[model samples]
Target: MKKLPHYQAGVAVVTALLLTTLAITIVASLFWQQQVQVRSIENQRLQLQKKWVLRGALDWARLILREDGRGSNVDHLKEAWATPLAETRLDEYVENGRADTEASDATLSGQITDAQSRFNINNLSTDGVINPKEVIAFERLLTNIKLDPSLAAATATAVANSQTKKTTAPSGPSIVTSAASASSVADTSTATVTNTTDASKSASNTGQASTDAIPEVQFLRFTQIDDVLSVPGFTSDMLLKLRDFVTVLPHATPINVNTASAEVLSARIAALSLSDAAAIIASRDRAEFFGLTDFKQRFPDKLTDVSANDLSFATNYFIVAGKIKLGRSTLNFSALIERIKIDTKIIWIREL
Candidate 1:
């Protein structure tokens, strides 16, 4: 039983320290691996929950469409559906896993349109020629609502200026003979002048244009509404106020009086006063105008300017939006939808 040398003792101490360090490193590595595994499991669980929530939205939409009985083709994907999503409470559905007897927030929210309506400004630039009716309608819209007088004038001037730029004929145009060409040019000029004069006259008739004028540009989309910023008197504040009420759709769908908001009705329907628009919205809470006939009955006086041919009850476009929260994650998605009737079944047309 002899005692170990001092040098040997030092070596033993160093070996003990090294082993202790190795053990700690192994324990730390194991702890980190366990944490990673826990995180992975949590993420998977959240993803599944999100999927369920999304499925719930789809099912809710289907149920609403079925109840409406507007045909299976009711455009459930439109903004009307999304408007209610944010306001709906999901507690009952999440807790019971079924629609409850009490009206749920999710149920109520599934009914309103939230997306911006389309205004179809592409017609304004067709073959580089603005449709005269559209021009008249647009000017009337501006005038009907008493939009910025300067903006109206500027837009008119821009349109007129754009129309006036003339293209010169080729120098060697002997193919059709000069006399015929001259006659064609004279007729063309006369038609152009007539159109310009007619548009001005129509604007005057509608009381949409003033004798005095300014300069401005027409917009075609929500993003392009900002183009008014380039106009001399259109302030950013004014454009912001107007953005929510306007849209540019791929094709024009006349405003449905039943669905049109106060802003839209005021701008597009000449006979609808702001008070009238407010009354319509108020009436919607108690009973919606189920069809154009119903709307006509409600506002018989206003119906004079709105023809039966110009009204619609069926809507083709929709916007669907979903918000999901699962565990620690939240997600939001929005989609535009179109209703297409195929054979006997209706289909929702989605972009991508």
Candidate 2:
């Protein structure tokens, strides 16, 4: 009987400990769930707030671009839109003394860049045909940047093939006819030496079997800088180096003399010396170019190879980049805007 009482006490002690542990576990689990719910709510709120802030910045850009269209028909670095916002407090832009309502911790900084200032990759082809002149210009640009000039033809041909490729329905249970095949070329000139045939025919001339089919990804056209990833040999390093000098636009655009870099100016004008390009950049600082005639008279020597069609003093496309931070969330965006005679429209926006 004494042993029975001791054993009963031990059982009671064990049962109490198990109950205590179960209670603690339930409380801890409930607390963790509450914490997670609070955090999720905070994140959602911050994301929504960040989205609105970025949208406001985009609207502000549209207003500035629209004002430029109403006032000046030309685009130059001297203009207000070309000047960058130098990390100003977000509240500074809020009008009507709304600083108390806006978040003070956030900052605003961005710039409107001239899209036409860079070489357009789309210029590689015109009306579904390879353009010899554009290929030469791109080669010169590559050479100026210390990249292999041979990459110009291959990149252009790939982009051209993507544009002209036709898609068909699947013909079999396992596989079907694809729109086009894109493969590596051993020689740069094999695909574009004559520039007379279709992109597929050019691929065939490389001595690869005509019946050989390789998978290819096609785009209606290049829309962003990263779109060049689809082109063979355009590695990340190459794109990083080229992004500063090239852009993709919906339509062909002439180079803006007042905004183009020295390298671009040198490449676009045949036989133009780098020193001459520097001189032009310096001359623009003294006075803004209002017309091609003004640009011509300033650099008469360099004008021999360039025509009026290849040059411009104005830009139709501009990129607006904006970033905003709220709490632990941040949002960044790049928008391409087109302005024509007081009418401004956002063509596309890419979230970064």
Candidate 3:
């Protein structure tokens, strides 16, 4: 049969199948793209919600700190702010339906620590000048931590240099050279070489104009305990050892006797031994020092002579850290709070 040319019939069926397959593929791709967009939006919503919940937690901590300040003048581990908040469900803050029940599981836990518990590195210097006594204390701290005691001088120097703004000569020989050359009308290649040489000579003898000679080194300002690494002798291991016993505050502050560790107390008091510091801490545990007089009286026979100038029984700085776990995601947050006369201020907040 001239019957419907068999080849053409087969071609038509093949063409139809190809068209159907392509259409199905395009439809599936469109669906996938739409699903991805939906998930992206949901993820953004979840991030926003989580941040809000964290903010609320920080606010709660602020309130607690304020109340603590109002109730007492001293900061100790037995206080309410020191008590950690256990991991508690946060369903009221975030819905558990976004993810499977397992994924939706949410909880939060946190605690506030007295920042003054450690020796504030800022204490090493006063008004841009290193304090000899403070430096000695820092030296002791380094020695106690098994780190090179010499780092104390370096740290103090760094802090001192950063705090004291000193006039520095202009940097960049090239820039100085170029400026010097620009002063002369030397357009020729030969003149360019001569000009650069002359500029180098001028720069060698305070060549950069008085205007250019400004404070060039306001070196790196240390804001945290980790900044100690910037010093030449400090290593990560040394920092780990010093971290619990050291701190960096905005200004010079006395070490808190009620909260300071034995290492810190020993470092603060030149005559005090490590064992004596520990004994003082043990005695403090039995009863928190309500005042400087109280702290001295409560300690053993030797501690009565301890200088109260560099010692404090009260705390003004605190660090609050917490974690919020929502199913597959976890948010770790930290903040520094300053308490001023029954009122507290949030110095800084960060996500860890």
Candidate 4:
């Protein structure tokens, strides 16, 4: 009886331990769930706040662009809008519990860039046909970036194909059958009918068998810079090198003489060399190009054939790129802003 009581006590102790362990596990799990929910809510709040900040940044950018356009017809690096915002702490902008203690370390920085600084890929082709001059320019650009120059033709062909493709609705059944295919031609159920000859039936069958059917093709349009990857020769790495100097805009635009890089300048003007482009850039820094005449005077020998159609002194498209560092995370974004007659509009914006 004494041994039995001790054995029962031992079992009771084990049971109690098991129950305690289960209870602890349940409690811990519930606590963990609550913690996760709290964190999720915090994340949502942060995201909402970030969106508000982005909107404010966009509005500020628009104002700057509009004001800049209103102030002058000529845009240059010296302009206020052209200046980059350094990483400035947003502590003053944020509200914390106390004036001295900071809850989040937030910083904002951005820059306005001329999209025309790069070569627009849309210029490569026009209405399903390649432009020889633009092709040569793109070829030079590829060579300058140490990529195969042959890729330019493939790129142009892709762009042209995209433009040529028609988004036709589901058309009615085509007349795939030849004139001799039917055995009898009748106006209606009660109308007079003429019988088709055996020779005609044989001709129809022969015609179908002799000629192969041509399949219809749907080409992909270029909407963004990465669409170049659809071309046969473009690689992701090649794109990284080319991205700095090339862009795919909505429409064709002339290269901006005031903002184009040395490589772009030389490529744009076939007669101009890289060294010549470098010299022009050196002088351009000293003086803003008020017109094509100012640009022409820089390299008279090389720019004799160059006209207003090929180059512009000002750009309507501007890219606003910015970074926001908040707490442990950093958000980088770029937006395309278009300035037309003192009015600024955002074409597109993306987060990176």
Q: What is the TM-score of each candidate against the true structure?
A: 0.53, 0.79, 0.80, 0.83
Per-residue C-alpha lDDT of model 2 across residues 4-121, encoded as one tens digit per residue: 6888989999999999999999999999999999888877877776677778888889899888888886788998999998876765543322246555666667899998889998
**Model 1 residue 336 lDDT?**
41
The 10 consecutive residues of candidate 4 with the worst lDDT sum are 185-194
Compared to the true structure, candidate 1 yields what TM-score? Answer: 0.53
User: All models: lDDT?
Assistant: 0.55, 0.80, 0.82, 0.82
Candidate 3's TM-score reads 0.80
Q: Best TM-score goes to which candidate?
A: 4
How far residue 8's Cα lies from its native spot in candidate 4, in Å, is 0.7
What's the best-to-worst order under TM-score? 4, 3, 2, 1
For model 4, the local distance difference test gives 0.82
Task: Tally clashes: model 4.
Answer: 0
Query: Local error of candidate 2 at 290, Å?
Result: 1.3
Deviation (Å) of 315 in candidate 2: 0.7
Q: What is the lDDT of residue 42 in candidate 4?
A: 66
